[model samples]
Target: METGTTTSARYRRFADLEARGYSPLYDDWCTGISDDTELLAMLDTLPPARRQPVLFLGAVRFVGVPLEGFATFRSFVLARWPEIRQVMRTRTTQTNEAGRCAVLLPSLAAISAAEGRPLALIEVGASAGACLYPDRYAYRYSPGPALDPAGGSSVPALDCSTAGPVPFPQRLPDVVWRAGIDLNPLDARDGDDARWLEALVWPEHTFRLERLRAALGVVRSEPPLLVRGDLTEEIVPLVDRAPRDAVVVVFHSAVLAYVDAEGRNRFRETMLRFAAARDRPVHWLSHEGHGTLAGVDGAMERAPEELDGRFVLQHNGRTVARTGPHGQSIEWLP
Candidate 1:
């Protein structure tokens, strides 16, 4: 478990780097909590994993706390620590941000084009499987062309800013099959599950909330198959179920941090085996916090200072780009 000092440092980091631009309300709250010794003591009592700002803030939001001001929020939290603690214990941060698909599109397109076959997508931590339908969402990458599916425009058009020689996808990948593995798979059609997802969205991001609603609508039309299990145990079975004619692409975003170091090592070994087996074309696409994946950091060739506060995008273990946590930007590297 993390000590009070470590928890406070995490909150400060979240305030300055993660929430500053995206959610001013959250930034202020985190900043305030970082300095409040009483709040830190309360937060430090939770499991180390639960001490993260996202889970804490999300728990409070889930409990219907008004997020208008830091003082009011803190007061409510202090008075109802037991209620919020229960929420923190029972709920995990399953941020199913469909906007991430915009960043994954290029990699998926490249793999499909190279293999000359449609993709069979297997998302490791697919909360409600909204991201499983990247083809169903339109794209508007700034300083570049807009892309829509063959059937025409779709709801929640994704907009991402690009830098470097980013290979803007000429067309969406033809996804033949999709499945997901999650410890607790959520149903987008369920009201409470859907509301929980909305609560996870940081306050002040109206655009993200709108995109999430649109994505939920898309998924409800046809939900992908989501298996309830651990990623390491469930992945192979799920991948084996894919069509042989299609290229299998195993991917995840902001998900591995929940897995312990040993679990991550096992997952890395599993993917390496799949890549080496080459029974068919299998690719692993990972978008995660810097250094979260083994060897991805060494592959970057960039200094640590250059990569601070960004998610590293890797395609089959090769560093490709640095991306915004919510898919707001992509700075291509490879």
Candidate 2:
């Protein structure tokens, strides 16, 4: 929760940009400023005329920080700046980039096997629920080995490489149910919400904004169940209601970094408890950085490596695989 002063300061900056009529090219301007060092460095690379708008957007976003941390700032931005909607929309598209999707196959396989039926996914930080539609789309690479029951394992290892584009299976999970949960759920059908999502995107990545618009067209027609609330509080109750025969899969990408340590623990415990109680299958998928917080200028700053690359797939309290950053490849052990 950021202070009102910080929120106001950020809004003012956004306002100044709007007044100047220098809208950003990309929607995920915040991410460009925050995550991608290359993009940040390139901000100065633009000519002075081009650089002003970019700088204004970044400065405004940076000022919006409630407590000088990425998570706090992101939350503040999402809650206060509805006009910045497109930024998030583009971010959703970039997040689902081809490379990242390739990395998710192993987890997909794990969920498929655990259900002993097919998979129905629940994404916590679904953004716009783009990745949830993996089954409906086509991928260019090949999937790894199928689950082997003879291995005396509840989950089988997927054999895949992490170097390049991996092939995804044409077969989608049965997908009896597909739902999403987010603190701020974006409804593509709602023009205002759609605009807010777009504002969340960085101005530098124009392609992502385009993808988001295209994705939104599809989502508007077939929207997933998206609930707005705290994930730690809402997950257990939701899982309890899931169909008994279907596997309960909970996944999040790049969202855990925003939650505090206590919140993270509570979310993990809640999911674990729910899975244990069901005596059925459960899968937890996450792509987030792990690390410790350090004190900087009397404020807590997370270590850079804290959020380094790692894709985790866990089932029934067991970790199936711990792979590199991109979800394209994995090293799974039964």
Candidate 3:
């Protein structure tokens, strides 16, 4: 595995990607970056956590998707090295995708019904806050009714198919107030920030771009309150601002993996403390990779293969279902 004295997570990530059927991008990078010492060195400049292949390529394509350069991955990347480095120094592969709303509404609806009131949303690693507007988006489910509002499709089209005992999410919860915290907060109103958010998407994904822009459009007139800081430290203060009448639900999707195990534990403990210190009902919904969440009672029994490389969606710290990495599809469990 070692042709040189240097080892990079970039290489390992590419290998993993190839196995997972994430084509062209993985093979292209693995072939190109492996041979180019300068490109590998530029990657070394990136923080260890941000050196994954997807982040690097996403940054490159953020400006434009590489099309003509497929013949030589090294040359294509080398040409953009300087610009990519400048962007990487500031950005953390941050994205504000709203597709997860399709999967999330089912849980949110149940929580809202139980609480008998509208829900307040507090999101961690929220990026540009598009996901903060899940209620504004429209959904089409396989075994479910059309989840559009009274009018036509309000936002972008979000479609998801569900299996098992997971019921169709017919009625959505009213999100009275919603806010988010991120390491580097992005504003959909800001040109550069919005462009960078779009850059985070792979070049082939026009549908995702449409969803992102649509979500941004929904919140443009009145964007959610996005605080810039660490999630573990910033969550409670934001929680304190929610309406007293609303049941606050703190949630995140595909976010905890970047957090170290200690940080993740701290986030959970802090939420537990916040919930216990009040009489109001508090909930945490997490949609993350299999091993990301620290302690869920029955979670350890499921192996990697059984989990199928999909993100696990949890409610109140319990495993409920496995979902596609980006929430494009879902499989419910009993």
Error of 1 at 108 (Å): 0.8
lDDT of 2: 0.52
Candidate 3 residue lDDT tens string, 39-127: 77778766666666667766777656455444565666677777777777777777777888888888888888878888899989988
lDDT tens per residue, model 2, 1-334 = 3333333334345444442243432223443333434333443333333334333454334334332434554555546544333332232221332224445654575467645677667878777676565444333333343422222221112224643333334344556677888877767787756664555456544655565676666567678888887788777666666676677688776676657777877777766666666556467766553331111121223445534345554443354554555344555544
lDDT of 1 at 255: 94
Ranking by TM-score: 1, 3, 2
Backbone clash numbers for all candidates listed: 0, 34, 1
Q: lDDT tens string, model 1, 1-334?
A: 5798998899999999888887889999999999999999998888897787888998898888987889998899988899999988888889999999989999999989988999999999999998899899999998677999999755768999999888888989899898999999999999988988999988888889999998999889988999999999999888889999999999999998888777887887788678778566579998998766544334345576856768989886778999998888899984
Q: Which of the predicted structures, 1 or 3, would earn the higher TM-score when compared with the native?
A: 1
Kindly give the stretch of ten consecutive residues in candidate 3 with the minimal lDDT sum. Answer: 1-10
Q: Model-by-model lDDT, in order? A: 0.87, 0.52, 0.75
lDDT for 22 in candidate 2 is 36
| Model 1 spans with C-alpha error above 4 angstroms | 1-6, 294-302
Predict model 1's lDDT versus the native. 0.87
Q: What is the lDDT of residue 306 in candidate 1?
A: 58
